[model samples]
Target: MALSEAEWKRRQEEEDAEPAYFGMTWGEFDRLPERKQQETRQRLSQLGATHVGFWKDCTLGKCRRARRCIGFLSEAQYKAGYNAAYPPCARGEEPRRAKIYYDGICRLFPEGDEQPKYDGRRKTGEEDE
Candidate 1:
């Protein structure tokens, strides 16, 4: 059945209007409730998060919060962040706590390697033992 003319016009107007939550500004979009934010995030992740042909730009900030919940970044940016955080130990002391793994470990690095071996026995991170 056809919607009444008035009803159809109203639907068209509603479609033309910006979402009440998103309003015409990024600031207003940021003010949306957490529930709404999450919903929109999920929707964006589904659509904008895609890979096109050779011309495609994979760097769009289309992180999938539903999958990992940590947000997203291009692989290059990810590597830079990872390297900046876990640079080779400044003085060659084994990094006590790797930031990517243990952020608070930064405090241990300044303590110096001479402080003492953590345990009577020690092994490299890759060591089988």
Candidate 2:
């Protein structure tokens, strides 16, 4: 499906700062190169900081900057969502910021399009609530 104009712009803004990945099966991410995979590891590292330490380096100052990050799902998240079964990263690719799949978006998780929340509420008064 075609993305809306605003949606296109938002994706572009995040293209550099916060990492993003299309809905891909785990098998696809596993096949990527090491450098590409390393980016996810870095994001996971930062995710660790948000919980354990007060001081942490911002990988990117803004989600727009983080958009360039290659952060993605490991075995767990992908397995939960993806329909097809695939082996996990066997190259010993370390864990990543499975928490922050998208930068700055802490609560959102990819449960297919159900989580994206693009559609309007069922009723008009629901907008206020």
Candidate 3:
């Protein structure tokens, strides 16, 4: 059954009302400490390749949010001179917050040796007890 216009609108509003991250806005994320922001950026970088692939596939496959993520990424790439002929989104409704959230999430957790060690002992070069 098709949803009524009112019902669809209500659902959209509810989704919009939900916070993009832990009840915090993009402004809040931006205002976080430099270390925190860097941490978030590192995590986001870990997911960067995957997210880019998802956006590219979505663009080719015509996913619903494709216009938003793809458009934003394409525009950014073009602006950065990475691509010379990227097309603008037809819908013109970029996923502003979604992009910010994803980018922030990407920076959260780092990998490899960059990850912090939690050994409950003195420094490696320090004299042992």
Candidate 4:
């Protein structure tokens, strides 16, 4: 996704201010040798934060419909929904967002859709007051 110049500047400033990965800016982290990056990732993976955190962050920020439908679902259930929503991401497209998948998830689970209203009318089976 292409970010506007203002957004890009904001993100750069934010990253510069906050530590990313292991006490370094994301740029610094990226500049590390691939082996070092892999090592850090492996350590983060053992802590159960890398992949899980990434997806949760994505869902909360970018997948509004998917986020709304997340109520009352177990981790496994949510994962199933996510897989159904983002097959390409499941296949191997890690850390990428796609509008198509977002739409797919919304279609698969319409919890975010507006609810219907019922007029205050009595049914035939009910006793009239």
Highest TM-score against the true fold, candidate: 4
lDDT: the better of candidates 2 and 3: 3
In candidate 4, how many Å is residue 113 off?
25
* Top-down lDDT ranking: 4, 3, 2, 1
User: What tens-digit string does per-residue lDDT give for candidate 2 at 1-129?
Assistant: 999999998876565444344553445556678646555444544343344321233333442244333333355545465311111211122222333333323433334555665766567786668
Q: What lDDT tens digits, residue by residue, belong to model 1 across residues 20-126? A: 33244444555667545645543333232221111132222332322222233235543454322221221112342122233333232234557755666666788
Which runs of model 4 end up more than 4 angstroms from their true locations? Answer: 1-10, 49-129
lDDT of 1: 0.37
What tens-digit string does per-residue lDDT give for candidate 3 at 15-102?
A: 6665544466555666778545544543343244234443443444443354323333344544554322122221223452344335
Q: Model 4, residue 20: displacement in angstroms? A: 1.7
TM-score of each: 0.21, 0.26, 0.24, 0.28
Per-model RMSD to reference? 22.9, 14.7, 15.9, 16.3
Task: Specify the highest-lDDT model's number.
Answer: 4
- In model 2, the runs with Cα more than 4 Å from the true position are 1-23, 54-129
Clashing pairs in model 1? none
> In order, what lDDT does every prediction score?
0.37, 0.41, 0.44, 0.45
Report how far residue 118 has shifted in candidate 2, in Å.
29
Q: Between the candidate structures 1 and 4, which one is better when assessed by TM-score?
A: 4
**Root-mean-square deviation of candidate 3:** 15.9
At residue 111, what lDDT does model 3 achieve?
Answer: 39
In model 1, which runs have C-alpha deviations exceeding 4 angstroms?
1-24, 48-129
Sequence-dependent TM-score of model 3: 0.24
Residue runs of model 3 more than 4 Å from their true location after superposition: 21-78, 81-129
Clashes of 2: 15
